[model samples]
Target: MVKIARWNHDGGTQSGFVDNGNCYALPAGQGVQSLLDAGLDETLDLARKVTGSATPVPLADVHLLAPLVPATIRDFVAFEEHVEGVRKSIDGVAGVVPEWYEAPTFYFTNPHTVTGTGEVIGIPAGCEDLDFETEVAAVVGRVPGSDGRNLTADEAHRHIFGYTVLNDWSARDLQRREMKVSLGPCKGKDFANTLGPWIVTADEFEALHDAEGFLPISMSVEVNGEAIGQDLLSNMGWPFAELVAYASQDSVVRPGDVLGSGTCGSGCLAELWGRNGSKTPPPLKTGDVIRMTVEGIGTIENSVGERREAVTRVPARSRPRNRVAPVVTAGT
Candidate 1:
């Protein structure tokens, strides 16, 4: 089952569920992680039996926070549709790079980029072309090295703590400009990343299946009341297990870390704009509310805000040792 940590009116946190009309707070520390730790098979069965509580909390009354405060955010470029859409939207990229099909590609985003649902995202100054990416992020449940090496599909599934909805918000203008530099997607991407209203465990949809008999979840997005994105979980180019294996290639994955399945096929700017070689993407502006929904994972709604020029940074110090190194060698 999916689990979430919601804020009470008094600004306190509690475990919750995203059900019919409202969020029902569960017992303390009983979030998706806690439930998975308890037992994936049993916890989900228990979740289905929860009846309506007398005192229910309105979804609006509570703040949705990131399901997992991962130590590091590793995002993978998996879906061909998403990649093709992106290439087509931007000029000059009309075909897929052969290297992309070789294996999964990933990039690291600072963990601090994470924000909760309903929080106002502060746009960076001079950056007007903002965009959204809807992704399904898997939380690492177990510590690495269970088998003393990498894990297979069967072993990897047991390590999944839970799942959550992730919005990899973007600054398209900055991204486009930066693409020419040969560096990774940085400031344009580092600005902000969003997670949960809640987290859903693997067991939640034991019965939900795709046409191929694989477990599947439904996903969709809405912007200012208009439907903009939709897809099924089974359509991912690679499944969670393979993603885990790719992420753990060097034996680096750890618990509480997040692995994002980059934007789903129709989950980003490229899809709507036809990024394969044609189409210009629609830009987001202030006051636009983007809401994303994943079948068992719940919804995350955020609004664009005016860019604020708050440069929160600390000065870096140069080392005197570097300058003295040459002098020391000569003296010696």
Candidate 2:
């Protein structure tokens, strides 16, 4: 089913099934990896056997880490809403490129970087325009080219370890500046990528995802208890199979590698930041709590901070203050 790792009242960590208060240990201390390493039939059989022995950690009590801490995080720009939203903000980026329309466009991210759920996220100095990106990430279990060939859709299905929610934090200013040089989103995206509360396996929600591995997941972001961006996973343009096919072109996709559905159209400040004709997107200030949720996946609640600085100077890009930097970066 939905396998997860957690800490208990005694401060001991254990791997278990996610249920309704306390986390009970799985007989073998196996988490999602165990299932991922298992074959398709074996995984499905295990799913039918394990009744959850654990309880839900009050969203605040549990700390969420990246589902797999992958070696590479590849974010795909395959959502039309995000494509259009980018166009609405920048003149030349409005329409989807013909190639992008036919195939998924993706980029690699720094796998070593990460942030846990409920942790305080600091805004990098000089990045006056930081933003959030709501997305669903797939954790890879099997590496491609194991048998001298890349993984096919069927192989890909068996290789998926689990799924988790991700918040691809963005520094719009830095991202734009870096892209202008034709290099890549080095400093912009490498700073931090928020992931997890738990890793929900593929079998747990068999009915949730379509044949192509595109699950109809609902997502939302709340700031200071107010709803900001929300949408369903159905809005995605390309399915996971297409992405896998694209990613495996002439190369291999590996285990613990992450494939992210780039920001769902309205799931960012650039899209939902302003109202009425003004472009003032409110920036996140210190002490502001942001709760990002995905139905069935889980919610990750984090507070904003400035590390050693005072809370008053932390920048936020919300409505009425849309002075946030422009959205001009490409995939990843």
Q: State which candidate has the highest TM-score.
A: 1
Candidate 1 has what TM-score? 0.80
How do the residues 33-132 of candidate 2 rate in per-residue lDDT, one tens digit apiece? 5655553356545544554333344534654454555667899876787767754453334456677677787878877777768778888766766778
Task: Candidate 1: give the clashing pairs.
Answer: 1-201, 1-204, 2-200, 3-199, 87-275, 88-275, 88-276, 88-277, 89-275
Q: List TM-scores for all candidates, in order.
A: 0.80, 0.78
Residue-level lDDT of model 1, residues 169-188, one tens digit each, is 98776776677677778877
Poorest 10 consecutive residues by lDDT, candidate 1: 274-283
